[model samples]
Target: MGPVSSRKQSIVFIGGGPGGYESALVAAQLGADVTVVDRDGLGGAAVLTDCVPSKALIATSDFMSRFKAAGRLGVGFEGTGDDQHAEAHLSAVNRRILTLAKAQSRDIQAQVESVGGRVIQGTGRISGPREVEVTPDDGEARTLKADMVLVSVGCTPRVLPSAMPDGERILTWQQIYDLQELPEHLIVVGSGVTGAELAHAYLGLGCEVTLVSSRDRVLPGEDADAATVIENVFRRRGMKVLNRSRASGARRDGDGVVVSLEDGREVHGSHVLLAVGGIPQTSGLGLEEAGVEVNDGGYIQVDRVSRTAAPGIYAAGDCTGILPLASVAAMQGRTAVAHFLGDHVAPLNLRGVCANIFTDPEIATVGYSQADIESGKADGRIVTLPLSTNPRAKMRNINDGFVKLFARPGSNTVIGGVVVAPQASEMIYPIGVAVQNRLTAEQLASTFSVYPSMSGSIGEAARRLHSLES
Candidate 1:
């Protein structure tokens, strides 16, 4: 045999989602022999199926929304009738969405390979603390040895036994892209981010959407003020908002599906999309056998540094049961690799992470939350400004949504904030920066912003909080 290579500390990552691939790339950069085992294609479910595809459809939906409003802005369309009809060819839209997702996956694969990381398309299971068994789709199984192992198996959409996805009328969020035509009467079960987003998108695409919420509001998990605004917006757009209704089961009724609520009410629709949540994909990986601790839901218990109970093994992403954001997964992966490689590392700080809900008027939140203040967990002052009052809002004919800012009482330190408006996803970045850097409200107020802009409201809110301090 030739001379042994110097890079002997091998790192094996099971799953190629944001968490797995990110860690693998980091480990490779740190001079470790890294291998990523992915059963699905490179970018995992987040890119290949869930996040990317949904956002692509949302983009189309957003365009249609703008097009519909263009008429009010002195922009008229040719061959217009009393009822302007615009149908979304879901097949064509879905084809474009998948194409974009697959392209991104290939780009990620190229990036990982360029960094000297090996990616294997196979299902990987931890056979031991430092060994993984990879079963390739077309080839035979093989055992790979590693100095350290990172499990980032991600998760699958949770489906109730009573409402299994038929890939036809009844569908999960993933099965939606396969639909050949737009749903005439789409019934979305669950009022979480996924449900609310798709309901909004379909409604914008001119479909009659009925949103079923087990809770009182559309987005029960989000900021209360933000959820209320989105729920109102949904109703104004002619979408049926059903509250306090829990789906017991979904069954085919004649040519359509009927969602039976726990309260004995049945809602009929051409198609039903289940957005209950996700179940961690941690089983069948020999985790418990190898002394890796898992919770009741099968999610691996991990520390801030992404370390599991077992030494030389770690877990990240949805499998860790941490905040199930793609950004958090990436951070956890990076932290895991940094710790494993003896590099300077810091525990993941979730408080600074920003999350967005993609609706017609998007809802974005960062840092601390109002619940913290109400519960006395955090002492802060809040100021909310309606976007309707902004000059930019008048020009764009965007009347709904608001900007809410929270600051610590004495120091006026900007801790958390919420933005509900068009392009709120893009607008929340500055707040994320301020929260991460611990910038005070005074500092934000002193900063100048462009006149007649939505972002100006953020600065204006900061100014109001600063004046309160004076």
Candidate 2:
């Protein structure tokens, strides 16, 4: 007599990006069998094309920004800031950095495989509510039946017909690596965080950079005051920021591109980097056939816990079209698995998610915003402390930016905050913890910060809120 085969429920995760791979690792640790499929290698677009590579380039720019501003900090420079002949100017080793960034991506792949989960290199789809079909690179077609399936397909750079990336004259953030030499004049289209960060990076790298913003200020999606500080700093750095300017298209003229703006204005440059946003990769994945709902933008609709309309299928990351950040993707993925496991779980809270734009005097915001509070969308009070007034600012030669906190009118609990200054990304973490843990202003104020540190401004802001409470 033959023994009967027993079947155990398996979790099939499609799309091997941050959302898929990270959760796959977590789910496996929780004693669930997981399989991840992707068109590219593991770690997905975030590691291969976006966050990791862009941050590597930004690191070079960060150092350069410091060198350019070093003179103001009482550091000696042999010549004028504009003097090309001067050896004391900011420089870059883009080639070395790009090489190192790629190596780091490979290392991420190694970590993903160590968790005893399977990552199949291929495209995948939801064949049915709880079924996944994978088209592997080896011409093998396999179907995976699972108790739950997670869709984390991620996204791709949005390209306009007018300025197709030629990988030389005009380029997307991903294609910028194809560049052999640093651009002499890089005209960046789009003034959002992506546009502003790259424009600032290129300018710091000694490129004559022009930032094109359709709005009156940079970082239109962020706090107005924060954007204003960055815009002012950009102008002061001679970045040639074109406000209220819209780029119509880009065309190759010989070896360069002349970016045509809406006002018949022409800006010629050695290269053009398109900092426009990305489109989620949801099409042709059999999503329509699987009874999953996709919005006008092609984003899959998911519930608070990342459950799609289809009972057994869930989606996360940029594929869900939530606010785009790698950290958010990871959280959504973990939430989806927790929800599927039938455990006590909470819906993902993006309010505590910190967003940073890596410009000189970086802008970081977390939780609720003053703009929302003032607009009546939220009810809260605000307290702002400019960095210039802080003793640390004077010692560090910091002349721009501030820390602004928002709290409920009566409860005085911090609802949200924004930091616009050097290393604002790092300073916003404590506020993020406070907001996430539902801590009150009094609780945050009680924490002591070292004197002569920028973080003291955060504690000071919390202390002022106590005065308002009294």
Best by lDDT: 1
Clashes of each: 0, 1
Backbone-clash count (model 1): 0
Please state every model's RMSD to the true fold in angstroms.
2.7, 3.9
The candidate that achieves the highest TM-score relative to the unseen native structure: 1
Residue 159, model 1: Cα distance from true site in angstroms? 0.8
> 328 in model 1: Cα distance from truth in Å?
0.4
lDDT of 1: 0.91
Off by over 4 Å in 1: 1-7, 79-84
Q: Estimate the lDDT of model 2.
A: 0.83
lDDT of 1 by residue, 281-387 (tens): 99899899989999999899999999999988999899898998888998999899888778778899998999999998999999889999999999999999999
Residue pairs in steric clash, candidate 2?
A: 38-122
Candidate 2: Cα lDDT at 333? 93
